[model samples]
Target: MPDTSLPKTAADGDAGQGGGPVPRSTALVLLLLVILLWGVNWPVMKEVVGHMPPLTFAASRLLLGALSLLAFAAATRQLRVPHRGDLPLLLSVGFMQMTVFTLLVTVAVQHVPAGRAGILAYTTPLWVVPLALVFLGERVGWLKALGLLVGLAGVLVLFNPSAFDWAAPPVLLGNGLLMLAALIWAVNIVHVRAHRWIGTPLTLAPWQMGMAALLATAVALALEDVSRIDWSGHLVVLLVYNGPIATAFCFWAMVTVNRALPAITTSLAMLGVPVVGLVVSALWLGEPLTLTNLAGLGLIGAGLAAVALADTRRA
Candidate 1:
């Protein structure tokens, strides 16, 4: 997960000084693939968490992702240890982006439906708009502001009106935690943007993943029922898919795409996730596929596209 810390000026500098923009078609396709993998992530995570304790599942995924990134970094010769000044920022990013965010989402899935969780999580972009304006001094024009409003409306459509029902404490708590997780993720993005790492994506990713894995493992050992793991084929599959494909590959793809495209475009592409997640839920989990949900998805997509198009024009 990228941080929000980098000023627009810095990002502009990086884009100008680093490699120039990749082709729009290429960035779009890569982001679409990234969204698909991430969309399916909700259902996959929900299924895995059903059998394993949340923290343990999180730890396993992080560990697998870390290993994959480490191997890639080694093979690519991008393995550089962070300087002393960067250590604290890297560790903070690992905790907020990988460890806490993953753990919270895993636990939240236990309380809410995967589709609902997916929609809520994608609201990260909505939160990011305000944060970016305040911290990065990124101006939010009328169109972007409208996009934010429309996106939040979509979230409202997804939210179950009876969420406050007394019998569904877990569901309510899970929903709240998911929102908090989004905030943490947004903060991590800002942090990353603020402190542009000198290391390449290959090097930085492994460091973050490894730190997340270690921290998650420690928490899992302390708080979760580690002995209750089933060690079944399903569990193994989930770990492998979530770790190598979802975490490692997804992270790498996201970094590459973000480097190629503007932040707005990258965020826009992620709007496909809720749609994909809803489809996965309907097909795989037999969740109800209502017209309202579909309509909300459309609205969200339009809003995201508007933002992306506006950003592209500005650029």
Candidate 2:
């Protein structure tokens, strides 16, 4: 899923830059598709790793997704190497957000339930509040502060001693890794906010994806047993979904929606991702949803809505 901390330029509407603004109806449809693809992908990735090593599966999908994005960029005549000045932001996003964050989520999903993993991973915006205060010198308005506290309360609820198994090493490791992934993504979002636009995020995405692909591949080769990969039809189907649909199409759709819709609308709507993930995981994987999970999800949605509204008001 795309970050909640949208760049200033994108938030302010860059629709006129490349092409005319998309129709609101069209943009909403695209946004819904993005939500479905990304939300369902949590369970998809969870299943993928069950059949192969996490890093290797991550590496393969990254490579294919990078290529697919490149093709999209080229077909649209938007393909170009990033400007020299964009390298710093590019490297930061590529390594921290795309590679490391993805690796952590992929690995952690092996031990964590996909529903809960989705909630934890998408907490990137909550982390962004603190990171932005430090890195961007942004003030914490009361609305945002309240939102942060509420969101964090939801996080604590998810980890409540009565509901969570704190004694399980695998559970602890998975939850910890997901939190780290959220923080890493938050850092990328702050950098995105601070970056001067040498290229629109869409224009630069393929390059960043390429870098991530290369780095993930190197790591996977060094650490993972590639031979363990099951070359089955199911694996192929899953990879196709991850590469072209989830990664490539969803990113493109999100950018389109960002340009067409108001920032607050986009951010608020994106919260549906974890909700969808939760429902899909329960139905598809037979993962039981507890009362604690429902309560936490409600609080998280409220918190995220408050934050999105606050951001729009601040803007």
Candidate 3:
């Protein structure tokens, strides 16, 4: 469930200070924390999925988050069942945002390094910017258009033939899957922005998360070998971290930041997730930090910042 204490908008200074717009500093801080949690989640997921099947690991994490949020909603008396009209939207969002996105990412990590996966996933903003313009009727300035081009150039840089032996089908397939996952995420974000679901975050979040858990669990049962799980100590720790901190807490924090910040700004803030993931993976996982990787990161960051700053000025 969303934090009840948090303000739904910055108009009333629900986050403190005067009853004005939320401070940029405060919004940035919250968004940065969200990035950090999500950034670390990649490597954590990679480690855990090493011991468990991808679908099963995703199922466990979602189930745990669902139970935790459900308990919180029940205890706080904040649970509200979705209306008939809202049910399909909520279920579709859950499937796209939670089940398909996580499952594809987990499977991709098995073939690609966590850092690479992080870099690929952050391309979501590139996709979202164009989608937003087309679907949401958001205007894209010349600067943002240039930024989108540069971001695509960065993707091409990362797609060098020498980066991975394309002869290896798994690696090629994994990269494609990661790209598909980003598209799914782009769609989910646009859907959320388009819909007018009438409920507080506390009431809505749990239902979406619970539905995702149930759906993921069902899929896992039908497809994955649950008996093959190693159930090691490291795996347990990673699952706990991914569920409670990364998924549950970060989801709420992201919603809070989104309410306070512009859509482009929020998406730009997520660029940090890949940066942190790359650095952390290099240090902890011994992943190589090559010149091409750094160059790609620089392009991505610059393009994202360009788009974000342009949006902020427009706002």
Candidate 4:
């Protein structure tokens, strides 16, 4: 998830926890890999929803991802039932971050280009500022406020009449849902910051994913016809890549990087995810990258960078 805490560094020696030594170079490499996987996942997911109903695809991936996480946890001897004290955090993250976020993005990508969808979804950091103020009663510093304004300006640029089609309800709905997904993810981040940890996030991850899998599966069953799916080799490859590589491996890599690098490094590095997503979408999916869209992406990236700087300063 969002690991905004300061880092454990033998290199930079930033103010953070003193954990076991991990080479800075190794951590950076892992961070880069995480970015690649998550960034490429946008286009991959777009392809996935094209092959089947969005919810059904979401359900399948979530189940596979949960199983992968479960296997990893068991192998590491970290598997356990949820602690009562951690239940709220687990449930909040499972539903908001895992299930709802996946569902929204899966559906939204149908109408929104994968590149634009990536930019919109990564607005989670921008939304986190206002959410933290309201939910966590955190004071908004000038940088955070400025970041919020700049980010909103970027969003406006994307939604302006010339950029987005006002007459198309599906387009509007898709963009709105993507924004909602970002907001929901921000809510989870806020909860994560507030909650006292009864179990480590890594330890609780399997349960969270499993819960998301079950909920998505139930919803997909009720709403979607599974028989309509036309399975093929491409779909199987995408599903396997999404579940094991993108979801499970990427999360593990991120957590590892978070523990090893400076919080600022991790946060700033993650901005690469959307950048890679946009580039890959353009190259792989041949999605048109209009000047207006690029301008919006630039503004959002700048805003997110400012927020990351502010967070590092605060930490």
lDDT of 2 by residue, 1-315 (tens): 122443455334333443344676787799889888889999999999989999998888888888998988899988987777668867987788778988999999999989888878876656665665566555656776676677667766765657678899999999999989877766665565555555666777898879999999999999998899878999899999998888767765765565555433454455567778987998899987788878877876787677767755755
Candidate 2: lDDT over CA atoms? 0.75
Candidate 4, superposed: residue stretches over 4 Å from native: 1-34, 137-155, 158-161, 251-272, 304-315
Residue 67 miss distance in model 3 (angstroms): 1.5
Q: What do the candidate models score in CA lDDT, each in turn?
A: 0.74, 0.75, 0.71, 0.73
**Tens-digit lDDT track of model 1 for 106-214:** 8899988999888877677766666666766566667766766676677677665655465678877998898898888777655555554444455568998898999
What TM-score does candidate 3 reach?
0.84
lDDT of 4: 0.73
Give the lDDT ranking, best first: 2, 1, 4, 3
> Candidate 2: deviation at residue 211, Å?
1.1
Candidate with top TM-score is 1
Worst 10 residues of 2 by lDDT: 10-19
Work out the TM-score per prediction.
Answer: 0.87, 0.81, 0.84, 0.79
Off by over 4 Å in 1: 1-9, 12-29, 162-167, 255-269
TM-score of 2: 0.81
- TM-score ranking from best to worst? 1, 3, 2, 4
Task: Report the C-alpha displacement of residue 204, candidate 4, in angstroms.
Answer: 0.9
Which has the higher TM-score value, candidate number 2 or candidate number 3?
3
lDDT of residue 28 for candidate 3: 74
